[model samples]
Target: MVARKSAFSSEYSWFKGNLHSHSTRSDGKLDPPQVVELYRSNGWDFIAFTEHEFYSYWQELSSDDFLVLPGIEMGLDIPKFGRCHHLLGIHKSGNGAKHLVKAPPAEKDGMAGAQEEIYRLGKEGYLTIYCHPLWSRVEWEDISELRGFTAIEIYNHSSEMENHSGLHLDHWDSFLRRGIKVWGVATDDSHHWMEDYCGGWIMVNAPQLTVADLTEALVAGRFYSSTGPTITDFGLDGDEVYIECSPAKAIHIVTYEPWGRSFYAEPGKSISSAVHRVRGNEIFVRAEVVDSNGKTAWTNPIFLDKKA
Candidate 1:
């Protein structure tokens, strides 16, 4: 079989979006329309109103420029971990007329119940995202057995703002090393909608703004997560991987090994591109660009021996 390459191309448009957010339907302070307006005015192409255990804003409010994807945040308390597993489900369509799928009570179901709920929602045409692993204190073993997830939140805005336990790059790398074909996402997961909004987002390259096209792009790994920097282009050619991004102070090529290559710019200087050769022993490799303002953009891992 032919190797799978990056799905980014010049033919598609890069749309910035935040897939996890909350509204008054759940524990969030803002209502659905206010949440939509908050993201829209901040230059978001799409926003999923992922209310806690509720999926209501499907066809409620949207516009020609901005799209509101159907989604919900399902949570369950794990007795073993002493924390909750919050799963973000961005559905291809609304959950019928009721627009809500009540979660199993956390007291009785626990982790097993959360996994079952994830599977059920997966079957119902939802893109499942394991949310805030670090914030929840979820270890690698806790998620090793779980399946049916499209992505994991590498950076959760609210989680970081509230508790400073948001960045989960180690958890994501562990999953990739274990042969999980999961993608990484960054989201605001905005509750207060003030300091949390626009902090984390994903830039998706899709043909259009429709749910189908965006979902396809996400599943195909045609996107990159960012706190500030923008990944203009990235691809592999022969043994070398090329990356072009916004002006950055440093560009790092990280792998499943102790050491990886990095390029640094001089003080007050910004570099926009770099190329690195793939080492043979490397299991997988990904790129991260850090701009001068301490913001970063992260690319999904590309397995060296297999297509990604």
Candidate 2:
């Protein structure tokens, strides 16, 4: 495990960026600079250079308008099991740990290996996340039962395409059913920054645009996942709540009200209007939209009146 590295903070700003990527550092072709430049040139406010199973987070930026967080994928090296390779989201750039996979101890080994490594990072204050639990059809029944990372990605654009992994809705739904309050993220899983890439993203509503701001927003779950549709405003009032989307083909108000009443507003779930209505004892409410290509937009969950 690595120690806390030095890095710049986003200062409570909305730094739109990606959480997963591959470069020549691992199996991907692009270099760090080329990867950074591609996203920066394309209006991406931030990016995490998750090269491989090694922790190589970069800090120093070319200017204030852009910032890059150094990171790496973690887990095991068992490519055959498809249970290897999990993502660790590092906020601090250059805190070099260099230890990719901590070898299993012939003696004191069990779940201690993963628990120690993960907990050690958490103890040090890094914002870690579990990326694409199903990248290899890996199950989340265990990870969902544990508490280590702060967030999870319901959709990893790139992996979903190459691996043909399901949309991850099943896993996300599982977490919800268990009362797990972990935040949900939708990432481009971008490696190409150019071309037909760059649709999976999170729209975070914050007062500023910086890494610190974005990180805080993320930890607080103040964001929405989207493939294309961007939700502007969504919330509830008393027995009546509302949602506003950006030119939606259809708006579905998915409400997990009362923290356990799993209900969604879509073609077969609730009502359709490109807008929604909530007048009941629901604890949470949100909006979603789908295009003809089956792309979806997930709005941040909103709190509704518990007594409603």
Candidate 3:
């Protein structure tokens, strides 16, 4: 059998979305409608109202152009670490079951509770993401032990705004290096406390603006997260990996190794695309684009040993 390859085609359209946001149902400033309007007006094709321990706004807020995905930010207080662990569960189906929506009890808190909840929600057809590990001051040991999460927040806008604890690439790379098949996602995690609403979002390649399509695309890793730049295209061609994006100062091919390939634009010149030869020993590779304005976009990893 021939070796499988990773590719991105022009058959699908890119939909911009913020997968984590809070409304008045939780500790957010705006109500559900206001939150929806904010994102819709700002050109987001989809939004997930991941209220803390609640999943109420499903059909009530969905529309033709704008899609609302039902989700909840499950929080558990870890006794050992004495910190709260938050997980984002975006349901595959818009309608959430009662049991999945409810939070786990305090007795089942901590690492075990987190793993249990992730597995449980995953069984119920939810995409579970470990939310803001750095912000939570989560130790690597704890994170490395957890399983069953679909993705982890590499960049969290709210966490960055509140504290300088948003970017967590090291934590993500650790898991990827260990053979865990988790993807990376960047979200606003917008409580709207600061300028967090549109700061971070994902560009998903889907057939249409529907929950099922979006979820499928996300699970398949046909997306890239960004704070500012747009990744127009990215894929691998034999030993070389290429990325096409908006004008950027730098395009980096991040891999399982500590050092990866990078293409930098000369002073006063901006580049929109670059290609790099992939090292044969690399376990996986992803792309990161940094615009002149200092904003960055991150692509999901492409496993070298597996079919795309």
Best by TM-score: 3
Which residue pairs show collisions in model 3? none
Clashing pairs in 1: none
Q: Which has the higher TM-score value, candidate number 1 or candidate number 2?
A: 1
The reply for model 2, stretches above 4 Å from the true place, is 1-14, 77-81, 92-115, 192-196, 257-283, 303-308
Tens-digit lDDT string for candidate 1 (138-214): 77767777777889999998888988987889888887777677899999999884588889999999999988888
TM-scores, each model vs. reference: 0.92, 0.76, 0.93
Model 1 lDDT at residue 91: 75
Write candidate 2's Cα lDDT for 1-308 as tens digits.
23321112233334567766766667666777787787788777777766554655555543577766656655643334445436465553234533333322222122333445566666555677767767745565345445666677778887776665626766665565455656678776666633424667776655565556666777767777887765555554334445555554456656664332223344544332343445555555656676545678876555444332
Model 3 quality (TM-score): 0.93
Point out where model 1 deviates above 4 Å: 1-6, 93-110
Reference-based lDDT, each prediction: 0.83, 0.58, 0.83
Ordered by TM-score, highest first, the candidates read 3, 1, 2
Ten-residue stretch with the least lDDT total in model 1: 97-106
Candidate 3 runs further than 4 Å off:
1-6, 95-107
Q: What lDDT score goes with residue 234 in model 2?
A: 56
Candidate 3 or 1, higher TM-score: 3
